[model samples]
Target: MTREAPRKRILLLTDIPPCSNLTAGIVTAQMCRFLPKDELAIFCVMNPHLRPMLCDDLAGIEMKTVRKPTELQRRVLRGIRVGRAGAAAIEAMKRIALPRRLIRQAIAYGRAVGATDLWAILQGQTMVRIAAPVARGLGVPLRVHVWDPLRWWLDAHGVDPVNRRLDLALFDRTLQQAASCAAASIPMARHYEETYGVPSTAVIASIDPALAQAPPPKLISDDSVVIGMVGQFYASEEWAQLVTALKIAKWRVGERKVVLMTFGHERPPNDVPDEHLRFMGWMDQPEVIRTLAEHCDIAYCPYPFAERMAEVSRLSFPSKVPTYLAAGRPILFHGPSYSAPYAYLNERGAAYLCRDLYPSAVYNGLAHLIEDSTLYEATALAARGAFLADFTLPRMERAVRRFLGYEGGKAGQAHGLEVV
Candidate 1:
């Protein structure tokens, strides 16, 4: 019999909690699911005021919650956001003051739990900045997972220019200090290596195995065809273009109708007519996938196209790609050619590609997928192949294992994330 690997206690010190239905929560939950719960613990820090987004899958895992954006942080951030001429607040935010209090809490928890390793998911800048130091104090290895480019993520969240520049530098330092790191996409991995001279493994999203075993979705009821969109909108400019494109595309094709069906986002888009919009509200990830499979004839995915978003566009991969691939529909991808998702899908011929932000391009790309049966079937087959080849539970599991230095036969190494 093969000898089972020895257990290594792991502490997940993160900014995103398991309760969020967002990418961080979904991806983090997947990473934790295969590990022994008894040897693992969670320390999450996020603003406590917002309602948890609820990913029921990870609720059973034990976790200690800490509040982020303390009153001082909030006031300082508000000052920066509104450009209140609060130079002191901006300066204070830019100064990285050792993160002593946060480090103390993490160390106490890590020692108490006998944690052998610290695995951080890059989300909140403060938590990410502290990861390297805390792991050093605990005398444990550190591994970080980056689902988005840290710089762009901060920019997207409206982090002020000064803090953002400082945080990016700290992020680079942490990357150098880490033993391994995992990125969300191949382009992201390449960017890390080329720009930072740090190699990282690409571990994108995955779908439940059961979802792949089933037959393709039944035809939508009635004469209406639906396009699927999942999760929150990150690129405001790109998504606004999509809204206009969907409008320009029209809602009817002969006797049949077409609509954009979306779930997970809290509010439905107000610009679209009720006739063109079908809101499913928020559902768990699994439920969202299954429902999309059942109701959607085509799935739409988006990325930013503005010059300002160019760097972020290349490094950030959407969580929806694998989920949509597993759902077995012809994907309608709208983004720039340089984008991670577009490049991946273009290479695989997995999705109908719309490579510009223009409404006409988006309208034409989606229309081709809907109107051309031959292209639709071919794209669907390729999408499934891509999912099976790269994005699956098994693949993600192995990547996570390698990142944490927990792969069955491998031995542990020095801390500081090198990216797995």
Candidate 2:
């Protein structure tokens, strides 16, 4: 008798994808790119209100659009909506009601597509209704990926005491229900285990290898120094802090320049007077890397004072950390000493860390790197080495596949195949 082919069906449920400005959307896109295309079938569900834009962008994947609510669903949705002000109320209600319905729909959709396994990516309180029952009812293992716990808590409707605690109760129940869970970083994983009493084995998060193998750094002119920072600008004060540091760097380096490169929806203020500062907005990944490698001399990873709380700080590991490492340059990190990237930097001897967001501190750090040729080369080389050893896409793929028990050749022997 012939052996059957391996089952390759998977259903990924998420809120944002190709059309949104959120980090979740970017991470979801990266996940799709990392998985073996021939071995995986992706089914995505996004906010119904964004269907038009998302439909066009998600052309290659199988997708279903879910609207905010119809007249009837709205009535049930309204009771669950959280927050007294803004659209948070409507969004809160939708989170509680939508996930349960979406999971049921996902089961039917997966069955129709001959899927043997189901994977649900839970954003926040939605985990309670979406992931729990599907794992129990379908007898298929479920994985929950958490990025921002605080954001989830605040944004989730009906989870708090004022909302009758229905959502919070359900959210906790899903933790016990899921077969496995994944977080964006080790810190996040720890948070999940501590707060929800989930097993450590259930959490997994990694950086893609493709991102690390960015084209080798290109040489630029020596007359001006370019300091680059990427990702969305959520806090304007943080941007101003960066700009202030850049201005201080300019004063020290004389003619050296600084530039802000953004990859999302946020735009820089038009009235900023720094000639050294230039904003390149919303570039694709390849373009973002190319621009950084060719023009940037230093990569700045600055965090403002507002992001210091343990609840917020412990749950997030900036995606840009690996991207900056892959750039083959010296990194200037302005954040807490206990941050994950700081730990990595200290381990590898690859970066400069600053406790405060002072201009003088920023200037001194960059000056040390620029002035000492030996230190500059050593730092860059160490960062690149660390990227290959720990943060490469193939490295991450192996870890994920092993965690999922998807990495055997015939019977039990694991074939160490290269990740494409």
Give the number of the best model, judged by TM-score.
1
RMSD per model, one decimal: 4.9, 5.4
TM-scores of all candidate predictions against the true structure: 0.87, 0.77
Q: What are the Cα lDDT values of the candidates?
A: 0.74, 0.58
lDDT of 2 by residue, 191-310 (tens): 677877765332223354455533333325556667777885543454566567665454346444444444554556534555645677667555666677777877877654464344
* lDDT minimum window of 10 residues, candidate 1: 411-420
Candidate 2 has its poorest 10 consecutive residues by lDDT at 68-77
Residue 28 error, candidate 2, Å: 2.7
Kindly report which residue stretches of model 2 are placed more than 4 angstroms away from their true locations once superposed: 1-8, 18-23, 33-43, 48-61, 68-100, 150-169, 190-221, 246-263, 269-271, 307-309, 407-417
Maximum-lDDT candidate: 1
